[model samples]
Target: MDYAGLDYRNIRFPVDRPLTESERAARYKQESYSNASPMDFLSVIKLNSNSIDLVDRWYPIKGFNTWFGICVVLVSMGALAGIYSALFFSNRTAPIETVDWIGVSALTPLFLLLTLGGWWLIRTECGRFTHYPMRLSRKTRQVHFFRQNGTVLTVPWDSLFLTLGESKSPLSGTTYDLRAHVLDDDDETVRDSFSLGYPSPLGNAESIDKFWAFLQPYMEAEDGVEKTWHHLKENTGYLVPVDNRREGWRWSIARSFMLGAHWPYLQLLFSPFLGLNALGRMLAMSTSKIPQWPADVERESQPEVNDPYVLTWRDNGSLGWWELYWPLICTVVGVGAFVGVIAWVVSGLWR
Candidate 1:
């Protein structure tokens, strides 16, 4: 049941309802699944109100509090400390301009940039529950897209691809990862075919197989000639070297250096830097559930749009908000801390 309350604050979604069935059918017959149905694009909000307790995010199976709770505390503490320092101390090197104060001033731009950008992005997540939809359909291998706790998509049969075979997992006997890709191109160059998460029954190979059978029809030859697909090798849990630079050797060098140069920036893009993890997480999570069905994906097709059901929902948690407030928060903290340094410096300079 849906909670009645709705929250409009910090919501962002742009939807153009699919044209009426008759209209869509006349426009594009092959792609149209239902003459009566149209693509219903919407953003749902949940809040605690007299009507109902509002919508909270959902994580399949089980999960806990978002980073917002912890982040707020950390931010508050940091802000408080900076305030204390700014009001009390001074710097030794620069008596006239306290180093602490100047340093805090330096962080202002970064925070402002992050906050405004983040607030703008919140609505695009486009769902009611915080947790992603975690499930597998017994009848159809279609991927379930949930928004406001309702199924928004029945992954087009042609969009899903499954690799069915014997693959042993560390714990589960044998498993198949229900792989799917969107039929369309992705927004970024890095991922032409984005991955949706794994189904609920990720642990058991049998369940994975059931998922495979349903998604199997969507499996088309990724290309006319054989090449390495991103989701291969993992199906058997065996390491087979592929001819691609995205993973393995070249990727390591790029990832290593990029991380070293900008780790702090990268750290903020995910949920709490990987805070809460679950047991059998792969089985429970969607990304973990689908193993890339190994196809001969040519390196030339580095960014290939092989399928259409690519799950590309992104949740940066409160980082966007955090980033927004970061500059302000950091400024407040820095200013507070800087003031302390200035005080110490001025006192000494005068003395």
Candidate 2:
């Protein structure tokens, strides 16, 4: 497929295009404050027939990184200090109360656990932050990690293991992590590692998977290992092309929910509320074609026009007001309810 016109793939970093004042400002804002979108982080740079570059320029926004670690440390410290002051310094004349001891006893272990966990997280983030612009070169079959001190560590492709790491949260379902680890001489000890930072729960599995699909073609593996890996990759549903126009918002929601449900069945219970948000997104897309791929690539990847299921919304004609308005109302209500529940839970926690 010809990707000559693709905004991401075609552009070189330190992008050559001249920027207007506003564009420059926007660029600076993105660099300083905003996280790089999945597209920007994983966008494949085809250097030549044998070489491709996958660079990691941003940290995963949603994880136990430096910011989260700092919050944990600050909160735990304040709570512990408050407890200590109330117990030891509030009234010097009063005998040490049993209740005070109980409070201290109860909170001490939890506080220690949180503090230690947060410290570990801080160290991990420090390592990641000090290493930026991690470059993986397919041609050299080597992954190059660029450190802050003008040093680079290169590990061959065979010395690395690519695996998916996942974590589950009550509020956000399950999040997937794409990580690469470098093995030591024993081939068992992990010498170094880094996450590629897609964080799939935020409707980004498709994008992450697409990036993985691109890498799989270049990755070298033994015959048996390659076959097993390919089978697993195909089952991941990342290779499936989503036709948003034909599938509509409903289909998108169903697909996302199914992905969630595949790992955790609890997500199935919330499908109704989730479907509402999905419907709203689909309604917005109804007004225009939501192209998931570049023109040439889309043309090449999509099935033949004669396929029975390829009819788009345009081909099927517009929905009547009766068909759209009811769903819109339900979606608004679902969003409101979801927000209210969150606010109530947060308020209770604050109190």
Candidate 3:
């Protein structure tokens, strides 16, 4: 994996190739079983004579409509306004009755809470999706974080640490979050951190290891004593998680759908907002079947061999036919349902 000459930023580097009998035997001897699959690495890695740059970006998943977020906000606000108008400002000709007053009083607080909650959710989504990407530079030995508002924070390479955080859900099993943190001058003070939260399925430790392996080589090359090596050794793994029974695109999509369905049942009443989020994720995962691996990972201990199966960006297209179908269906259904709801509400108001 000599990534020195490869332009990882614009290219889709192939992380797997057909192994020869000798190679397979060698790998089997090294590890009895292989847990890692042929995965794709979407991030960009640029190498220079004196430095390397890695950029992990948040890309809109294929089959997931980004515009759905806008639709969700608009429909929610519209519904809120409609409800308020219906409850609080009904026709003057129809004298305000005791029951009407009671209804208004009861529903007003609920409406207000829903309005505030919707706004907060919209803001959170915008922050998560539209924020700047994470950039790491080896030349300067610094990691630069760009905020949504164009602000940048730079942290020294030596100060950086990888933290693994876990969350358990009774319905969806356990999910892990990989976070990058920077410690302050005293090394005891924590300055800043960011996370690529729950990037893969449960038990897929290889994804986390691959992400860390990208930074490990550069970090180790730095001129001072490394404090994070122990952390690295602890987190890194040789075996990938495997299940032969559940394989291929169909199984992957089913697993993703089940995971996405983990939203609390109580939240179903707020389907307009929560449903869109889940639907977007489901579509994205279903359409993108290939797993992604980190590019330019240093394998210093392995023998050098030219790989003939390497793939370039030009060889790949944006989305395949099957991948495009589900997203199109989701878009049509989402739009149709949205329009029908609006029409029904407007008709009820007229009545």
Candidate 4:
């Protein structure tokens, strides 16, 4: 089933049966790794003493790249149609042969496939919220997830069956996402399931474990958020502000390609693809609406006046000259390169 933008795949834990040996092994506790911090808290929207609001994990790169590929395919298809028109429909051209019809017949499926792909991408990516956010309210002892269909799923925090989830795709190998299963009245059947953070690559279990460890105390601790979890609160390095508003061009380029790569050489290495990726991401974001929490959720999650633990993207700090200028320069060069390459391809197809 598809929830938000993610497809639930390879759900190993049986919804109806008791946990098997392997499934039991995958189950982990909040106390699994003490003093651990979240690996993908980039989704964190608002963090305060009582609650933490987070956007659902989104695959910006994948969505942007897929849309880009579709654009190129559409352009190529247009060029092919033009070529066919010149050969068969123009009076100045030689008589169309039976072989030409056969060629068009053979290519029909490919054209249809490309059209279907473009349609599907547009259908999925457009007219949706930029993200689905979830709120973890320590005071309420409940979790509220914003569903894509405009419904909210509320469950008690302690009752959630938090476990390691594995999903495999040919493009991306076995990746892990932290998921919570909501049990039915029987307490064994999984009433529903949803992922918490972004998926991680294999061998990153330690980081995920620590993230879980960090969250447990943040909720369970009786002291003020500052007194008990000040250090953990400061760890908002992964927080990138792309969800609530239109991201700046430099940020789009920086976030779309070569994330966390500070070295100039690495930036230059990824520069060529950065421009188009930024454009793609921008296009996707423009079409999507920003998500908002329900009124009741807003009421519960609101922080106390003058609360010190409240955190936002501003805490991540401003970008440097090189960080800003280099991406802008690279984006210009990359867009020029992309145009040149597409021009060459279209010209060759025309001939």
Score each candidate by Cα lDDT.
0.28, 0.43, 0.39, 0.64
Q: Which parts of model 3 have CA positions greater than 4 angstroms off? A: 1-41, 45-95, 125-129, 167-174, 196-206, 218-318, 323-326, 337-351
Instruction: Give lDDT: candidate 3, residue 349.
Output: 68
lDDT of 3 by residue, 133-241 (tens): 4445544555665543345566665555555534454533664445555555554444555543234433344555544444444444442113222222233211111
Clash number for model 1? 48
> Best candidate per lDDT, number?
4
Every model's TM-score: 0.28, 0.37, 0.50, 0.83
In TM-score terms, candidate 4 sits at: 0.83
Across 87-169, the per-residue lDDT of candidate 1 in tens digits comes to 45636454445775676665545544444444332322222233323222322323344333232444544343322222343
Q: Candidate 2 residues 225-334, lDDT tens each? A: 24323433343322112223233453334433443443333443453454443543343334333223224322333434443322222332243332334444444555
Off by over 4 Å in 2: 1-58, 62-64, 91-94, 105-113, 145-173, 177-209, 213-351
Lowest lDDT sum, 10 consecutive residues, model 2, at 1-10
**Rank list by lDDT:** 4, 2, 3, 1
How big is the positional error of residue 18 in model 4, measured in Å on the Cα after superposition? 7.2
